[model samples]
Target: MAKLVERRPLKAWERLNILAFLKGMRTTLRWLLKRPITLEYPEARPYIPDNYRGTPTLVKDIYGREKCVACQLCEHICPAKAIRITPGPAPEGFSHIGRAPAIFQIDRSRCIHCGLCEEVCPEEAIVLQKEYSFSGTDRNAMMIDKEELYEAGGTLPDKYFKWGKSE
Candidate 1:
């Protein structure tokens, strides 16, 4: 006696497709006559949703100071280690000044924009902003410096958590 091999049955939806094909055709025809939803490049631009992560924004602290204490928290948090900071001296009247970074840089060539730096920053010195319309001519120009990042980024909130004001 020969034994028959059993096979799994086809899905119910796939078993019957004549009506489905007609419905799909009708939908396609309706779409064909409708207005085009795509925007033409070099002439038109699409809308980006709010809170979209586009660029890394640098923020300052209260008293018109830099929020970063140069603790190297963000640098350590960055998986790519794209962040570089060099410490500097602090102004007078503060004997307990912590490490102050004179050189802060973020290499766009390697940055993943994971927002880890922002989340790990004890001072919230950085944030992912909505500035997505950035373009560069060369690799050298893409490496953002401290002053440039601060200038390009939006102003930090008037009072951050460190300043004792609630969000």
Candidate 2:
């Protein structure tokens, strides 16, 4: 069985709805007197924290040599399957390292920017940089190749070098 509910008649003031309108206007007027907190973009970028993860890029050592040894750890650990690497024999001068990436590419559209690639890299070559405003008109333009990654990452000072001369 359904329960019956009593219906009540509206008062004259409630039917006019003037109180609701006045309440809404009061809220609008209160906010209109305050200053806006809008940020002027392009000229002013928001503050990014030290631990902020933006995009993955390849870095070189302080000596201007590539730090990645083509370990493929970053590619294997990537959840988005955005990273691709083709391993090749290390250059003649880089005898200490066994292999290097003949070709390395990352599809920006597929990347989730989870920082897993950075965390899995043994040589710390791949890192999440503070560059978040990457845009491209086409799919090909969005793919980050090895050269481009290195150019964006620049070089990072390292305390240990596998190919460093003995003291």
Candidate that scores best on TM-score: 2
> What is the C-alpha lDDT profile of model 1 across 13-88, one tens digit per residue?
7788877899999999999999999889747877767657777878765455666678888888899888998877
49-117: candidate 2 lDDT, tens digit per residue: 967898888988776777899999999999999999999888778866799999999999889989999
Worst 10 residues of 1 by lDDT: 158-167
What lDDT does candidate 2 reach at residue 150? 92
TM-score of candidate 1 relative to the true fold: 0.66
lDDT of each: 0.76, 0.86
Query: Any residue pairs clashing in model 2, and if so which?
Result: none
**Full-model lDDT, candidate 2:** 0.86
> TM-scores, in order shown?
0.66, 0.74
